[model samples]
Target: MRVKSPESLIAESGADLEGHGLKRTMGLFQLVCFGVGAIVGTGIFVGLSDTVAEAGPAVLVSFVLAGITCVFTAFSFAELGGAIPVSGSSYSFAYATLGERVAFLVGWCLLLEYGVSVSAVAVGWSQYLNELLDSLFGWQLPAALSAGPSDGGVVNLPAVVVLLMAATLLVRGVRESARATTAMAVLKIGILVAFCAIAFTAFQDHNLTPFLANGVGGVTSGASLAFFSYIGFDAITTAGEEVRDPRRNIPIAIMICIGVVTLLYCAVAVAAIGALGADAVGDKPAALSLVVDDVTHSTVGGGIIAFGAVVAIASVVLAVMYGQTRILMSMSRDGLIPRVFERVSPKTSTPVRGTWIVAVVFAVPAAFSSLDAVVNLTTIGTLAIMVAVNVSVVALRRSHPGLKRSFRVPLYPLSPVLGVAFCLYLIWGTGWTTWVQFAVFLAVGVLVYGVYGRKNSRLGATPRTGAAAEAARGA
Candidate 1:
C-alpha cells in the first residue's frame, strides 16, 4: 500500500462525505422566521408557569434581566456567526480559531443543549396535549398515560409523538421543514397574542401589588428559567449554509428574533399575571392552563391556549432537532464524531441518519425522564456554550485580523466580556449540582475523544492512515 502525500491527507481532512446541500437559499425573512420558530416555543407556554412559581410577581423582573443578558450574548453570537458562515454555527467557528479540543467541548455542550431542549419542548407538549384532550372530551388522560416523571406522570406519550413527528419532517428537507416551522410559529404567536389580549381585559392593578414578593432569589430563578426561551437565538447560526448572504442576514435575524420574542413574552407574562394575580398564577392546580381558564371563564379559551401550547412545543422540537442534526453533521464532517452522521441523502438534501439519531436520542428521554431534571441539565449546557461563544468572538477578532466580518460586535471586547460575565452569573445561579453534572459530562466527552474521536478525527486522520490506505489500495 502506498502512503498518500501530506497535502492529500489535509485535503481529505476537510472533505464532506455527506455532501453539504445547503446552497444559500434562505433570505432575511426566512432566517428570521427560523429564529422565531425556534425561540417562541415552550418557554412561553409551560415556562411561564415555572417562572411564576419561582418568582411570584417578581418573575417580570426575571424576564427583563434574562432579556438583557440575552442581548449581550446575542451580539457575540451575531458577530461570530456573521464572521464565519458555516453550517455548524459556533462549533465550526471554534474549530477554525480555538483549536480542536475547544471545538470538541463546544460540540459536546451543544449535544446537551439541543438534545435536552427538544425533549423539554416535547414534555411541555404532553401537558397541553392532555389539556386539549380534556377541553374537548370533558375527560383527561390518566397520569400514567400522560406527563413526565417530574410532573407526576408515568409516561410521556405525547412528547415522544411530537419528537417522531418532528424527526420525520426534518428528514424531508430544509425548505419544506422551514415552511412547516414558519406555519407553526405563526399559529403559536397568534394564539399568544390572542391569549394576552383577552386576559388583559380582566386585568386588576392590585394583582401586581407585591411585584417583588419573591425578592432577588425568586427573580434570579425566574431569569434562569426564562433563559430557556432565548436558546432559539443560536438556532439561526446552525442554518448558516442555508441562509442567503449569511454574513449580512444572520446577525440581523438573531437580534430581530430576540427583540420580537422578548416583546411577546413580556406582553403575555404581564397579562397572565395581572389578570390572574401572581398568587393565582402560582397556585393553580394546572398552573398555565388554569390561569388561561380563570381569565376567560370558558373552557373554550383554555382549549385555545392548549392548542397554542401544542403548536409552540411542536415547533420547538422541530427547530431544535434541526439544529442538533446540523451540528452533528458538521461534527461528523470534521471527524469529531462518527462519519455516518454526516451522510446527507442525495435525493432529499437532508441528513437522514443524523436526524434519526437525534430523534431517537431525545425521544427516549422524552418518554421517560423528568422535565426539571432535563431542563436544568440543558440550562447548564446552554450557558457553557454561550460563554464559549462570547470568548470565541473575542479570540477570533484578535487572532484572525484578516478575516472580514460582515457584522461586528458593536463594542468589541466590552460586548463579548459582558456576555461572558452574564452567562457566568447565570451558570453560578444554577447551583453546584448542575456544575457537577456538567463536569461529568465533559469528562465523558474526554473519554470518548481518548477512545475514538482522537483516532478517527478527520483533523488527525492523515491520508496515510489505515482507512485511507485501504481505500487507495482498493483503487
Candidate 2:
C-alpha cells in the first residue's frame, strides 16, 4: 500500500494547534530562554572538573576550540531552520530534501540526542544533590544510591527523581516549562559569574606554567567534553512551530545564544584554572562546589554554588526533555512513529502521552545506569545528528535552488563544509567505542525503518495523483 507523503502528515499532525484549546503561544524571547536554559547546565557544572583533569591548564584552549566547532555547526542549523521552518529541525529538513527513510533515521538519532541527554543530565543532578547534602547535613547519600555502577554506585534514585520532576513540568505545558527554565537559567548563569569573579581575585600567575602538561591529545579530549556545553543552542531551532516569524527569528536566536553561552564557558574555564591550579581543580571531585570552596576559603560559598548547580541541572532536564517531546511529536505526525506519541492535550497544548513515554525511557538510565555510559551515548548521538544536519543543509541547497531562504549561510558551500569537518573532528575525539556503538545504533534505526517506518510513513504510503505529486515536487 502506498503511504501518504510526510507533507500530508505534517498537514495532519498540527490540526490540534489550530483549534480552541491547543494553541502554542511561544515567541522569540521565550524560545531563546529555552535554548539558554538547556545550554548552561551539566557541561559546566560537572564536566568542567573532568575536562580540567584531562587537559590541565590547557583546558582553557580546549574551550575555545570546542566553541569554534559549535559556532560552525550553529551556522548550518540556522540555514536549515530558515529554509525548512519546521518543528522537527533536521528530521523535517531531511524529509523534505532527502527522503522519508533518511528522515526516519534523523528522528531516531534525535531520540538519542535529546532523550539520553536528559538521562545524562540527571546523572549530573545526582552529583549536585550529594554536594548539597554533604554541605548542609554533614552527610551524603551512599554511593550505591546516589551514583551509577560506573561511578561506584549500583542505582541512582536522585537522578530518577529529577527526570520525573522535569517530566511533570513538561506535561503542564511549554509556557510553564519555559518560565521555569528561564528562572533557573538566570540563576545558573548568575552563580557562574559570581564564582568566576571570586576565583579571579585569588589567581596565582605560577599556576599558568606547565599549561600543556598533558599535551595536545589531552586538550582534544577536554575539548570533546566541553563540546557538550554547546549542543543545546540548536534547541532553539526545534521550536519553529511556536516561534513568531521562524524564518527570521530562528537564525538570529541561535547565533545570539551560541555567542552568549560560549563567552560564559570560557570565563569559567579561565577562572577555575587560575584560582585552584589545574592539578588541584583536576584532583577535586567533579562538583562545582569544590571550585567555590577553593576560591572563598569557606564552606558557605560552596553551599551557594551547589544550590546553583541543582537549579542548573534542573533547567537542563526541563529544556532537553521538552525538545525530546516536541521532536517525537514531529515524528508521530509523520507516521514514522506511532501516532499516539503525537497526541496533544486539549487543555495544555502539549503532547501528554509523548511526555510520559519519554519520561519512562529517560527515567531508567537516570535511575539505574552510569553517568559515563549516558555521556558517551549522548556524545555519540549528538555528534551524529550535528554532522547529519550540516550535510542536510548542503543537500537541501543543491536539491532546491529556487526555494526561498530568508537566512542564508554567509559563505555558501564553504561554511557547511567547515561545519562538517569540525563535527567529524569532535567525533574522532570520542574514541573507538563510541564509534562502534553509534554504528550499531544507526543500523538498528535502519532496521526499524525497513520493518515498519518505510511502509507506514505518510510519505511512502500516500499515493499522490499526477497533479498533487507535481505540486509536492514543486514545493
Candidate 3:
C-alpha cells in the first residue's frame, strides 16, 4: 500500500512526463471550452430522448440531480487538479494518495470513461449527420453505410470518420484542438439557446401535465441516464498539463463549464417538453430538432438544430479523445503500460502515437457496438472513478496535511462522503447488467496489472514508503 507523493508529482509536473512536454497553450477560456466541448456533446443532442423516455418531463429535475452529484466530486477534483496539476487526473491523484495498484485500476476505469465515451459521442454524431442530411436534402446515406450492424447496417462509417477527424485535430496540436473546440462550443450553445427560445414561444401547459409520467422510479432512472450529459466536466482536469496557470484556471473552468451546461440542459429539457409534449420528445432520435420542426412547422428549422448537433457531438469526439490520449500518456510514463504511449512528438508536443491508437481502438467499437451499452458502461465507470477521486481527496488531506491547496472542499470530509454516497446511489439505479460489465472490466484490469504493470512499474525499483515519506515532507 505504498503511495506516490503529491509533492513529487507536482515537482516533476511538466515536460518530463513525456519528452518535450505538452505545450501550455490553453488558458481559462480554452480550458472551459474543453470541458463544455466534451460534456455538451452526444448526451443532450441524442441521448436526451432516452433520458426523457425514462423520466418524462421530470427529466428536467434529473439534470439538476445529476449536476449536484457531479458537483460534490468536482469539488474534490478541483482541489486535487489545482494541487497536483498533472495529466493523469484522478489516476494521478489515486497514485499519490492510494497506491500503485489502485492507480493502475483507476486508469483502467478511465478508459471506460473517456475512451468509450468518445466512441458513444461519435455514434451520436453519425445519427445527427443523418438528421442534418435528411433535413436539408430529404436524403441520407444508405443504412449499410450510416448504421451499425445492430442498427441493420454494415458499418457506421460516419462514426469512424468523426473519430478520426478528432484524432487528426488532436495530432496536429493542443492549441488547434482547443481553438476548434471553443468555436464549436460557442456555436452549439447558441443553437441550443435558439432552440429553447423558439420552443418557448409555443409552450403549452398541457404538454408538461403529469410531469412525473413514469413516477419516482422513472425520475431516478432518468437521472442516472442524464448523468451521462454531465460526464465530461472532469475532462477539464485531464488537460492539467496543457493549461496555463492550472492551479487557478482548472477549478474555475470546471465550475463554469458545469454551471453553464447544467443550466442549458435543464432549459433544453423544459423547452422540448413544453413544445412537443413528453411522449413526442421521448424515444425519438434527434429529439430537439424534431421539436423545432413541430413548433415552426418547417424542416429547415430542424435542419439548423441538426447541424448544430453534428458540430456539438464532433467536438466531444475531439475533446474526449484528447483526454483519453493524455490519460494513457500519463499511465505510460509510470511504466504501467508501454512507453510508446508516453512518447511525445517533439514537433507537435502531442502524444501522436497514442492518439491514433486510441482513435482506432475506439473507432472499431463505435462502428458496431450499441450506444446504450457504451453509455451505461461509461456512466458506471465514471461514477466509480469519482468515488476514487473523493476518497483520494480525503486520503491526501490526512497524508499530507501541510500540502498547499488553492481550493479545498468546503465541508471537509462531509462533501466527499456525500459525493461517494450520491455516486453509489446512482449506481444502484443502474441495471445489474452494467454492474456485471464493470466487474468483468475490473477483473481484466487486475490481470493486466499483475502481469506487466507490477513488474515494470517505476515504483517497483524504489523503496516506496521511505521515498514517499521524504517526498511528502519535502513539500
TM-score of every candidate: 0.92, 0.94, 0.97
Pick out the ten consecutive residues of candidate 1 with the lowest summed lDDT. 1-10
lDDT of 3: 0.89
Task: Report the C-alpha lDDT of model 3 over 5-92, residue by residue, as the tens digit.
Answer: 7766766566565548787899998898888998998899999999999999899888898999999999999999998999999999
Model 1 residue 51 lDDT score = 82
Better of 1 and 3 by TM-score: 3
Model 3: which residue pairs collide?
A: 15-21
How many angstroms is residue 125 displaced in model 3 relative to the true structure, after the best TM-score fit? 0.4
lDDT winner: 3
- Root-mean-square deviation (CA) per prediction: 5.4, 2.6, 1.9
What TM-score, to 2 decimals, does candidate 2 have? 0.94
* lDDT of each residue in 2-79, candidate 2, tens digit only: 323334434553564334223556677777777889888888888888888888889888888888888878888898
How many clashes does each candidate structure show, in the order listed? 1, 10, 1
Candidate 2, run of 10 with poorest lDDT? 1-10
Runs with alpha carbons beyond 4 Å of true place in candidate 2: 1-22, 467-475
After superposition, which runs of candidate 3 have C-alpha atoms over 4 Å from their true positions?
A: 463-475
**Residue 474, candidate 2: how far off, in angstroms?**
12
RMSD of 1: 5.4
